[model samples]
Target: MAQNPAGASAAGKPRTLAGRCGSANWVCVAQCIDVTCVDKCLAEGCEQALDALAQCAEKSGCGPDDSACVSRVCGKQCGRTFEPAPPSPEKETTDPCADASVGAGKVPEEVVGRWTLEAASIRPEERPRLAGQEEGVDVKPRPDFESALVVTSGGCFLLRTKLEDATLGRGNTLEIRSWGAFQVDEKKDTVQVWTKSGQAVGPVCGKPRVIGLSKGKFQRPVYTYDVEGDTLTLTAQTPSRQTFQFRRQTQEQKEQAE
Candidate 1:
């Protein structure tokens, strides 16, 4: 997990942003600012805007709704407001693998193996194609993504994914490695990974879209798996309900490739 610059500066305690507004600078003095907002501002080097917000907060005497107050004040100086992001609609814990239908036996046992990604694709409906990308043309995900997953007998899993998208920006790539304990319902043919707080590792693209994924378990998407001989397929639904697919790699294939 990446430590916040503000928090890291104070020997683990959050340090206030620079400002001189006395008590009204409550937002700056906050033990922790909204990470998403702060990160965005820092990325853009918006110190002046931050200082303006601090000054506004100090003068305005923000009420109980600190977020709203910050938004209202910061908007004036920054030309944009800072509202808490809307909660993911996918927060409902609906298990898609609830039905005990296809798998021959326990899902955990069936999924205990390594899988290599062959291809990946993102639906256009979920994210609009970048400029100059022809509509209706199938863009192969292999060039943009390299990923693999390993599931262990002891109900643990490790996944690594690296993606490159030139359209995002010059030389920007997203890399993520996540590990956590997993839960499987044998009867339901379902699996969900309960990630620990700081499991995500490695550098990721600086694009705002990928930045959120740096934490890795945002909303903790659910997944269901199917195995057919040497072929294993796992399907996952994103927070926006977009499905992603992954295929398994045999031990022989993995070793030979290595």
Candidate 2:
């Protein structure tokens, strides 16, 4: 019967009790991520999971401000783990550059530059077969497709891609561009992208149109990258893991700025 921040039920019942959930209930919600709570609910066959979650907050008796209860009693009893609390400032070193260098990979310095995608391929085993193709065929981007990844000095990255496919029709290609902040882990040889914003340019109803990306916040498991000579290869985990091979853009390409 009450309204919550996420809105209300069609029948005027509370859709979410988040506002009324005590600190304990909120703690359980955080831990339910990646857990088999839904499966557990199905097994129980009666919304026992929901009842358990609601009971967490109801029994805690902690006030809205008492977040400590989440860890000290509620979360622990609920068998959920919160990401470890961040180290206190006093416990952390005062070096400002420490944060910058911490995850920088073994050769983070090598990642800073303009790189152009030469090829992209997906593992055959993980992807569906193309029409008239064999069951295990690794798919590669068409020759006309163009992609570039530029990493600047201060952890900023820009990605641009263009593709020409028969499916889209003759003389028409789709262009996609996105920019975001990124962090590199040198030890892990990985990169993570965040805060992505971008747009797509393509034909719509026989005319060119530009449309913005609907995603505001984006992130994924760290992508692995390898560099050799002027070549860079980035492997990302998608529905099927994909590998994108790139080459450092030459002065000529930079000047042309396609």
Candidate 3:
């Protein structure tokens, strides 16, 4: 019998085709053409074509000795082409919160107590002058108002204010209540309050109107504090720069007043 180019005997002969062509190439040839054609092609020197088909099969992610891939790539190498698969889509990311803490902070133990507002005053330079008023003259009259502050040990606070409304009838008061959490830095002598909720109940526009306070209107009401005996003085550092003197209230006094 004549020796094949692959160094294997013809089919039905003693020698097998395993060593001459690798398992993958043998499978590819078997899938693409008949055994007689494989022997003839090898005899005719089709080694270069077989090598190119194997390379195309590797690039197209064909399984080792895959019969289906051999049939598709080798049998149709003349007209068919192969391309790599597309990548998968990426997952969407989550959005972050604007303010996760919302100004949450700790309050010092020394300043955690109920304080009654004794007096409130504004500096002459900080006060806005009246229209057409003389430079040295101070004509703006102060509004009659009273306020009280309560600071709990749990870092919470409440501020209640009652101002006599001159526009409304006599004895009519504009009552305002604000409550929130407080943060204090004793080393810096500064204290700040985060107003979470508030409301106003009084006569306005010819009727008794209860209006909710604009939450977070006072973004940063920072104040420098000084405690002397039973008195605590808080001087505002932003917004309306004013001084507020408060007297510490005893539990008996608070109960009696309430």
Candidate 4:
């Protein structure tokens, strides 16, 4: 994060943007100022706007360090009186995975960390075609993307992917995120992931959509896995065979890479 420029108040004392917005709201405020007119509003002492942005960030479940979510969701309303449209009253549905358990399996010590996707291989016949491509074309090219996987010792995991679209700007890139519980069987060299929830968010030719995973139901996918030094390989067992290679990432490296 870049340091905010120091500004002077009428009392002739130097004040920073972080100081202007209380520490609790600083993260969202900083992100708002970066992509909107929140900085100017702050200089003019717009407390209401700042408070609204902070509230929006919290209600939307954005993490403290999630600048992208802040900018995307709260930026437009930063300098104005934010009036969120009331959500239509609908029946609340319970999430099946809210209390789903991984059940009776331990996460391997070597797999309990962050990993970055390094390479992937798929048979030519099973390769996925690019959007809008003609049929029967063997020109299956790998999509430009970055992905990260986080496996926890507590049997939980998160996978995040950002698919790059050359025609879209950085602010509107496509992102897929999923979180679930995983069970590893050392004896069988297999890992099973039960996806609790997943979502896709971004623009497709200027049309934005947020689609749920598999109609909001749970999915269990199993893979044969191998770990050698820092490298981890996962090969699909059924359907079409595909393999993915990942490299373990240190805390510092993960921070810098992000």
Candidate 5:
């Protein structure tokens, strides 16, 4: 892993693959993030950090095909080829609940439900990054988040809140049923949801001042159905414009034995 160059970032963040993933409750997601960081060249083992970052940008998610990656990484002066993430069992899921029970909600809610935010330093005026993730250090400054969470039917919510261990997140503080409603456009299949409290939700001290959800407004949210094998990615931005991602979870309840 890489660390921030001295006198550069005051908060000495990891500049390499080792320190990127902050905290992941799921095995697959964490592994994917590690792969993504390597693909991004954020890890230090690569020598030149920017060159590595540029090279990594060209890998996996940013690439068009298995070989092509983002121009930034590909265009780096370094004479090298960015290898793609090899196929792995980490991609397999036998649990029926991995996807939604409808037409396009194939994303796993449990994976998609919650997020672990480390920092969101982007400004809204800048090009908005996608709602997804990478790995990094644990949060330092806690933040404030909405009091309510929302979810679709046959679904449940999962989130790492902003409240500290002293207040909202104290003993028995997490309430699974304490969720907000997602307004879905039934006709168009679009959807939006909001926090019942403030726009920001989560630890009061974490970076990324706000974890704005993928579906921006509380009005409508992009929905999921029974689309098979489709990946669901949701990024949240806080007031400070930090970014985070979540993979949606789904499942099928057994019909009562008549």
Candidate 6:
């Protein structure tokens, strides 16, 4: 398992994105209940959205009404009568993996440290064809022989895969997961990397998609990392053509404690 980012600078704790619940975000009715006495969401500019949801749910007999409300909230000051704004509403969203039945396991304590992406090996891919060529089109994930990103925890990573060119950019999802269960040996100066998913998977042209995998209990015994010169280097097997190096996160590099 890998560690989740913590401290002040860690990215916002991964949470469920709104539209991820279903194929859409504008839910006509709560999957379970509708509390608003009046039809059509009466959220006057998102300010009263949460309150309305809570009140409506309570009125409609939804148990723990407060927990049922979910809306995209803003952090702006909208005081018309010179009063503090109401707290934001909460919603019940399933983790993306939960739908696919994926769980965030406890990353090992040693793996809890940070690792810089010294190398990102993605294969060359074709741009989205306009038309006509759609049939024989061979679109694949662009190879990233080099790039930047940091690994938190030692398990699987779900990341935003964007390839940039000045202001213009191309994008897709990229998966880079460790091969097997992460085992730590602070005394041996070695970090064993194995494959649970057998091999790294895809560059599927979609955002928020799982790419590289280690599905079960880390299968492939792929790379081996050696802590050298304040950095970690990972080597892949033949035909894999990928090498990754990382540096243990230092105290200063740690996000300021929140």
Highest TM-score against the true fold, candidate: 4
Q: Residue by residue across 124-229, what tens digits does model 3's lDDT show? A: 4423533355433422223554456766656666665554523112322344555666678778998776656555445432234444443223333577888888
lDDT of 6: 0.28
Q: Cα deviation of 174 in candidate 2 (Å)?
A: 3.2
The alpha-carbon lDDT assigned to residue 144 of candidate 2 equals 54
How well is each residue in 96-158 modelled by candidate 4, as lDDT tens digits?
A: 234436322468899888887776553334335344555433222235456667777777776
lDDT of 3 at 129: 35
Model 1 regions more than 4 Å off: 1-107, 127-139, 163-175, 197-217, 237-241, 256-258
**What is the descending lDDT order?**
4, 3, 2, 1, 6, 5
| lDDT (tens digit, per residue) of candidate 6 on 1-258 | 121011101222222232121101011111101111001211212224334333433354433322222111111111221111232122222122222223234444544545544433321121132344543332222343212223335343322122221101122122222222344445554444332332222222121323222222222233445556667565444343334445565666546310
Q: Give the poorly placed runs of model 5, Cα more than 4 Å off.
A: 1-121, 125-150, 154-160, 165-178, 194-231, 235-244, 248-258
Model 4: ten consecutive residues of lowest lDDT = 1-10
The candidate scoring highest on lDDT is: 4
The model with the greater TM-score, 1 or 6, is 1
lDDT tens per residue, model 1, 124-151: 4423634566644332444544556666
In order of appearance, the predictions have TM-scores of 0.42, 0.49, 0.46, 0.49, 0.24, 0.29
Score residue 184 of candidate 4 by CA lDDT: 89
Candidate 3 Cα outliers beyond 4 Å, as residue runs? 1-105, 126-144, 165-167, 202-209, 214-216, 238-241, 250-253
